[model samples]
Target: MARIKPQALLLQSKKKKAPSGVSVPTIIVYILIVAVMVFSLFSTYKYWSRRSILQTQDGISNRKFIERKKSDIPNYALISTSKGQITVELYKDGSPDIVNEFIDFSQKGHFKGMQFTRVVKNFVIQGSKIENSEATEDWTSRGKHYSQLNTSLKHEAFMLGTSKATHEGGGFDLFITTAPIPDLNDKINIFGRVIKGEDVVQEIEEVDTDDHYRPKTPVQINEVTLKHKT
Candidate 1:
């Protein structure tokens, strides 16, 4: 082999130093790949941050939703009479104040052993504040005061009715109508209606009654059991 001149060697070295077409394209691809990777990382971080914020908001909303659901349900009153057990479905939608009061009284067992002293034949059977006028120490000793009566609840057939005498003396008495009495729907607090065992009401109404419309033979409410629907 012949030795190359210095000038020729320098020229060959310069040609080699210049990037090839393939090399230039490969560099461009690498830069694009690096940019995509960086963009992907930024997008992932932003998505996670937004998801965390949404989770926090959902937590608070979930708690409020549960509380509202709890407040919406109205407790049922299952009154066992001498004829048969009558189940009444109370309405808490129209009268929250009355419903709460009734539930509180029921929970305290204020209705146990209360007689159905007033049974209007073919109309309604009323009871609740028997002790209020019975003069029994046990009856008088019980709490008689309830919150101010809202005169909005009315007496309808099968609908529950609260006595409308005066404040602090009306929470204990209640009545159930046997027919559709819409006129009384808004005038009194009709909490609920008999969902079952209304036949027992007809039997009680047929019983012998005194001039005051009270059943000659005492018909007592054996127990009033409050329950919820399954």
Candidate 2:
């Protein structure tokens, strides 16, 4: 204690300066840990913010997708006949009411298996009406005459025309005008027209018929199919 050696003095001084709990290296490690925790919090906040933004963008995208899908529906029809087939382009733009009614009748298969019963030379071959006169008579006996509510649409050649009803009831009847009769245009409702299959119409018109104007062999309508164009 009175006179210590240099090496011993150095060791004693080191011992005396030793920390009670933590060392310098431990303090540096604690500072590094705090920095890492702060950085982790900042990264988590940024990630959350980005995720929220993405979610909002996805919602907007989904809304637009649904709106576009709703507006994409088309209106048209495909009528299949035994005499080849007829592609009818509906005139909803000019005749919405008649077109709607025609679509309804077509979809219900009301026009299926009907004959081209009334074929006038150089004129329309009428269909979509009951071929059995007995059935029509029965309907008449019941005080019902099939009549369609009149629409503002006019008759045009190759266009669909409905029959006027004189009695209480009206059934589905359609005719295609053979030639452009401008005088007859305003008298009837023309809902659709033949885009193809005019040859079929010509074939039907050429068939032989009896005095009652009935074809010797009926030209049957196999089916009427409705379709929307893309």
Candidate 3:
């Protein structure tokens, strides 16, 4: 046999060499690609999650408001006003917190000497503000407000609503509607209806108001007495 050249043998050896596993640089590139993909997915998930939570908050808060059953105490609200007395039969089923708190405060004389602060002709006449009973200017439905509840009762003709002057919430101000205000239904709290003196509510509404709907003359709430049936 002829002697093989060392160069030829070396070439043959090089050609027969097997490939090792993936190179360090290639493995590093793969790891980097996987990390980037994970980061992108995580960022997308975070963005959508935060958006969903904020949207649900508003709906949840309104739905979470408490509703109470009518009490056995024969609850009634006797609003003695300058125009006349309006007797409201309190409801226990629609909104309990509003009814109970209002009666509780009325019994405590918290609403003593309060007055009607706002009036909308053919719509509503709101009062129950203890402050600014004398001053027409700088007084709103929020005057002396102490309670809050999500709207429960509807605004029908001769119906009563208690709300803020701006209708924002938590003024504990009284609003009595002489006409059906479908827009205000489920948007404000109504704890009672005028079982007596609906005409009195109309009389209060007929009182003159300024351009801002503030009564030109003060309509006083002499007292709010909570009475229970014997």
Best by TM-score: 1
> What C-alpha lDDT does candidate 1 achieve relative to the native structure?
0.69
RMSD of 3: 12.7
lDDT of 3 by residue, 67-140 (tens): 22233444778889999898988875676777876777676776677777777665567675544233444333
lDDT string, candidate 2, 98-160, tens digits: 777777777788788888876655445678565434343443332221122133334345766
Assess every candidate by TM-score: 0.57, 0.55, 0.54
Model-by-model lDDT, in order? 0.69, 0.68, 0.69
Q: Candidate 3: which stretches are off by over 4 Å?
A: 1-72, 128-155, 164-171
Assess candidate 3 and give its TM-score to the true structure. 0.54
Tell me how many clashing residue pairs each candidate has: 11, 5, 4
> Residues 28-133, candidate 1, lDDT per residue (tens digit)?
9999999999999999999999999999999999999978876656568888888888888877777767777888787787777677776655456677554334
Q: Which stretches of candidate 2 lie over 4 Å from their true place?
A: 1-74, 131-156, 166-170
